[model samples]
Target: TQLLEQSPQFLSIQEGENLTVYCNSSSVFSSLQWYRQEPGEGPVLLVTVVTGGEVKKLKRLTFQFGDARKDSSLHITAAQPGDTGLYLCAGGFGSYQLTFGKGTKLSVIP
Candidate 1:
């Protein structure tokens, strides 16, 4: 099974600061997806990277897939309090189930 490990399980920052979080796995995957979950809601899909070394940006957020497709990173620029949530990374290996990371909890203080 491919297990994704996330760094700095918890993060706290003041609003307008920038932060970067990472997800890594020892096994390679066919595709990787990033998600964010709020208090009482299911995770919302943020982005999906299928090609190695692919980079995608969503406003102030940027995502990149590793060259070998075994890792990914998310960077938030000038973060706001609304950006607080649990970030998760899931890897697909052509199976019905996806291997998911434990997630990184973030709190942006206003």
Candidate 2:
């Protein structure tokens, strides 16, 4: 029942650097998810955190959900040019519908 908000609406970094993005909300959620999308393609789900304080990692990418279930974060290590994309955070409230944040656009330059 909460709306997610993402920070750093836009980001640009050089390859091999690390970066982190955040999503926050005032209302609690049952679950939260992170996704990555390219310009012409649909978003690809990266991770889902249902339990508070949960942390998931995919290679060099790490995702974490806050203990209060009202916030989340994503971190990328040694970012590469291919890592450039739109990062989205969505929260679910035990239903099929999901409330998404204003996606963070990332640009990794070589």
Q: What is the TM-score of each candidate against the true structure?
A: 0.96, 0.96
Per-residue alpha-carbon lDDT of model 1 for 2-106, expressed as tens digits?
Answer: 688997799999999999999998888889999999999999999999999999999999999999998999999999999999999999887565988999999
Please give, for residues 3-108, the per-residue lDDT of candidate 2 as tens digits.
7889999999999999999999998888999999999999999999999999999999999999999999999999999999999999987777799998999999
Full-model lDDT for every candidate: 0.94, 0.94
Q: Give the TM-score of candidate 1.
A: 0.96
In angstroms, give how far residue 100 of model 1 lies from its true place: 0.9
| Worst-scoring 10-residue span by lDDT in model 1 | 91-100
Off by over 4 Å in 1: none
Candidate 2 regions exceeding 4 Å error are: none
Q: Looking at candidate 2, what is the lDDT of residue 36?
A: 95
